[model samples]
Target: MFGPRHPLMLIAVLLIAAAPAPHRPRRIVSLNLCADHFLIPLADRGQIAALTRFARDPEISAEAARAAHYPVSRGTAEELLALRPDLVITSPWRRAAIAELLRGRGVAIADVPDAQDYAGIRANIATVAALVGHPDRGTALIARMDAQLDALGPARGHGRTAAYWQRRGFLTGAGTLVDDLLRRAGLANLATRLGRPALSRLSLEELVANPPDFLFAEAGPVRDQGTELLTHPAVLRAVPPRRRLHIPGALIACATPAYPRAVANIAAQLLAADRIPTRARSQ
Candidate 1:
């Protein structure tokens, strides 16, 4: 029972007025391809202001088709400022300088690291979902992902060794998202077996000299000299086409909503490749 002019009531009014206003970002910008993965799936389409230039590239982004509807940012501080984004998602690994500049300007930003495994993917999804003010969406996404993984059942590889061979003689190794994917499929990575680093090159001769039980390469035509090496005569002789598993480049580029697709594709392709004639699969 206090009067309106009571000092205690006056203090309460002042406190309420001084409290920061609650806000949910309506204009979001993604500064890296990795951020684009989360922003596209979790945020409302209208909430998106701009995405990275690579967002619509099917060669690397699984959400390329959906991303086409959104505008893209050049990633420069000026361009980002012009968009007047309320929340900017960035990968400090890719554009640290730009993030720093934006921070100095008092812009709200969130740093999303590149996910390296299933756990990392879950963490990133949760981070983006909460940032977009949809924590429930994040939970739903993770639940869907868990269900998809559970449907994959146990690993079927039977400890067979497989190499994720790429253009330019590059080999994906352990301590990476691909390595975790390989493990989930019950296949041992050739790079892990050979004690190779996360990323290393092997000459055609070296690859043939100690080839894995299966070679996994990107599907599509030979578009350049680098890709041409994947179809060289020696490579074909070392590992026949039947033993060469092909996966789309988009599926394995990152651990986003597309990750479950990548897992299913690999599992399906490996099962099919396993049915090849023994003679044809032999080195």
Candidate 2:
């Protein structure tokens, strides 16, 4: 005790004491489906503290099965805070109050913007990658996406002159992601052609009077009771059967890497419809 420790031993002790600890994310909470997509694929299995229940809903998420294993959390401040996550990821659409509360607690919150189209999807992917410290992986994923787009080749003018989207009376207009997807698939959006900012609810009479060359509606069971408009006898009588196509809601709603595949599916259907005999065209 009276003598000083050996210089080498003291130096070794100081070096051990001053050494930086390894960085490992201990807890992560994802508040939205999009964030679920980004966080689940990138984070270590045990690192994910919670995920949204919607993340396991196949209708909304492409990787639902993978996301189902994690504990689910609703987008509530108290629930998220209880998880004590080191990092939280959410979409812009998440409740503002929850985001505020988390930020107030000094937790790092990453707000990923909603993707309006394919490009926006890439941007969101990159942003999430950077936030999670996986910038290179993000770049590679986007490169693969760009490669897929490149494979689509020049757009052919084989689609119908006008196409109608009949999803819950909401029309995808110019400057919207659906409109851009339609254009990429070689179809002209009737909503855009009519100079409408987006879809204004139109009556069955209006639709019958000026029918689009093609009528596409959500393929699955109607969610809203009002969706009876799609199958009303009057609506059916007004629309020629040959002009209608049922597109899966999953194809059009989530703007993810799977979106290009959805566009391809739509384009294939449109091309097939174009081959129908003129006699079969809607009168």
Best by lDDT: 1
lDDT of 1 by residue, 1-283 (tens): 5766689888999999997653568899888788898888799988999999999999999999999999997888689889988888888764567666767666687788878899999999998898988877899999999999899887778899889889999999988888888888889999998899999997888888887878988667899988898899988888888788866877778777777888898889887877766765674
Clashes of each: 0, 0
Please provide, for model 2 over 1-283, each residue's C-alpha lDDT reduced to its tens digit, 9 standing for 90 to 100. 4267678788998999997653446788888777777776666778889988888887877668887788888867778778998778876656466566866676777777767788888887877777766677778888877787778776643455444556456656777667777778777777776677855666666666666766776555667766766766666566666667655655555666666676766666766766888877654
As a whole number from 0 to 100, the lDDT of residue 145 in candidate 1 is: 93
Assess the local accuracy of residue 233 in candidate 2 as a C-alpha lDDT between 0 and 100: 65
Which pairs in model 1 have colliding backbones?
Answer: none
True-structure Cα RMSD, model 2: 8.7
Give candidate 1's error at residue 83 in angstroms. 1.0
Best by TM-score: 1
lDDT of each: 0.85, 0.71
TM-score of 1: 0.86
